[model samples]
Target: MPSVEATGAKLYFEESGYGYPIIFIHEFASDMRGWDAQIGHFSRSYRCIAYNARGYPPSDVPEDPQSYGWELAVDDIAALMRHLDIEQAHLIGLSMGGYAALQFGLRYPERVGAIVAGSVGSGCHPAHRDAWLRETSVPSRIFVEHGMVTMAERMARGPARVQLKYKDRQRWREFILRLRQHSPQGMAKTMAHCQAARPSLHDLSHQLSDMAIPVLLAVGDEDTRCLETNLMLKSELPNAGLWICPNTGHAINLEEPAAFNAQVENFLGAVERGSWLRGFPATATIPSLVRSRGARRDHSLIQIDQETEGADVVRLHLR
Candidate 1:
């Protein structure tokens, strides 16, 4: 097994093909294998690297509960890149992985060529932060008490994930099998430390607005937990383009692999050609629900509803 020593643990990673580097980061519920669909397609055209974050097996599972967290996860990405001698690479992450990729760009702006974050924010909303923290902690107990078997049973059918079950039962079953393989201790610590405690994206507006790296913020329209914050990300990130997979939910990359691959491929090509330029700043148009009263710069809502292949897509259009 190919692995890199990072932070206090060894991260197991897989690599293939040869071209501009692209690193795949997995969600909390997944390990490096979650990116198999992407790795197969992208490795043909890019140097695809996928790694298991610390605590995921084949990777060391640190015993200290405090060892796992959002910051540590970002550190693992930086460490992996440095060990691989990659100064910069395109980052593709989903769910918890999405959160890490976004933060990686913020913390290491100079080392990011581009970012494609799917279903990035779920429990980071301002209006429900406390509730999210409480809810996120509940899973830690469930994982420690009832174990991974119970986790796969519930998480696979979560509101944002059920779309995968409905769209492709076989794939969903594969997802469950993978989930079952994860360490219950790892999942518990992740929920308690990383998911429950990472800084809210809404709190990083200025830093997000200043980042010039091309970003593709992809999310499913029915992933209601992430929609508001995705809108916030679009409003703040200068070089971001939002893509909402209509009639879809979370596990988007799995539920709609072809669309996900195509959108990412197109975005990468555009960025390479210098066609994916920054969008106009919209700090003045932050939604009241998304921004603090003290941070408000504008008051009107500017939604641009678009249709591609007949599915309604909502986009921000500040003027």
Candidate 2:
């Protein structure tokens, strides 16, 4: 409904359900309503929280691009978690949200119980960014510099196909139109931050291994944006599980909510049973999850081994 002040800007957010806490973050140009399906499903057993990040609809729009950087966005999340007294929450983010969540988890490891990062690769890979810059940059810059409809032709491609498959032409049109209304400058700033503050989880690999927190990494099989990145990440994140959804795209959460929710539900169940966390209860030592791995030391980088369980084999390199 209404937004709250986390740091300086107003962030729109909604809370629903009534069990273990789960916070959902939306992608660029989209708001908390993106989680409508997830809230409906997960609210039945888990407390679901979805929020609009700064510079999005129903949220404050800061003029300075610096104000909307990824690190700042990550800080906004951390502040919100503290403001809401959410000690530990399962972090679920898509695309830009994924990058923000990763930064938040690295900064406030104690406050995160588990993490589900979709449609985002291990941050800052040159090839990944290059591809994104080509396919996404023009549209992003057009939308930001000129106007929303500058690339309406391009934006319609994915949403149009989605409408055909589901027979929801009217709804699809509205969704795309709403995304078009987003501040072009704001969206550009968000993208710039994502590219500039890109983080490497490689150094944190061993730290993650020791944390043993349940992590589920997912990407659309056809999503050229983050598929290989996720594959690379699966190898480094020791306790992480990977899923590649078929017939999907970069916007997998919106394009395939059923599969997305199922992956989240399964991981949450494992978390409850302490199977994924290796008997290390979330409340007992979440901060310790990242800390237990101790200092970083030189270690051989692990490579992808083979394909297993629908995901590529990832070798875990512990330092």
Candidate 3:
């Protein structure tokens, strides 16, 4: 029941355990409950906080569409941190939340310890920008006309979500039930303004190229919409490491919680040990691996070999 006032709304957040904080942000189709698996695993060693974003129940839902935006989303994270008297915390966000985490790190570099961005960059590609905008509005209208039950069922079965349905039917059912409880009006406005109106990740390359915070960019191999954009993010962000889960989809955490949790713990461990290096060296060569046509299906992990000044090769493993 704990809550914090953030910008124009109040955000409901839950926390457990104690230590350096780790904040979890959910995707559009989920709420703070989506982070249950994370909180259970990480709370033993780290303070885990997950919050319901504005427009989700237990958080204030602003009626005006103008109240929802990418900037506001970024500010909400800051506001929560400030409200809790946290100087800095590791941020982990998924999909919509992932975009906010990246933007937050960019805007407030000094306040971030590290970032785990999962299943992001869906509508950010220029090639799919128009189609994304068109498709985004369809859900908004659906919510307004039919309500959460209809929208939740439809969205739960989306191509990017199929993996979860097949991998864990019970978990997928719970996710749909939670999604069905969201506010219809809040969802409608969020879909229209926040998701569809946000700027493309391609437009932020200049800023991402200079970011100094350690970032782990994670996405599912089957999440076709985000695959290319995540690759672009890895290339642009000097301090970013990428992870692509095999046979997975958009909800990587839910589909493969053990793998997702292990990868994150390792990243955080490296950061804590000061072993996480800065961006790739200026002379580092990133080969053109992606093909021009059709998706490639190589199970071998994407490895980047970087030769440091001491002639030691640092291998970056993207699994």
Predicted structure 3: lDDT: 0.90
TM-scores of all models? 0.87, 0.77, 0.89
Tens-place lDDT digits, model 3, residues 224-262: 999999999999888889999999999999999999999
Native-to-model Cα distance after best TM-score fit, residue 96 in candidate 2, in Å: 1.0
Q: Write the per-residue lDDT of candidate 2 for residues 234-300, one digit (tens) a residue.
A: 7766567889988676667777778788888888788778766322111221233334546233332
Q: Candidate 3: where is the Cα deviation over 4 Å? A: 278-280, 283-319
Compared with the true structure, what per-residue lDDT tens digits does model 1 show for residues 217-242? 99999999999999999988878999
Worst 10 residues of 1 by lDDT: 277-286
Per-residue error for 54 in candidate 3, Å, reads 0.5
Better of 1 and 2 by TM-score: 1
Error of 3 at 166 (Å): 0.8
What are the runs in model 1 whose C-alpha is more than 4 Å off? 279-319
- lDDT value for model 2: 0.69
- Local error of candidate 3 at residue 114 (angstroms): 0.5
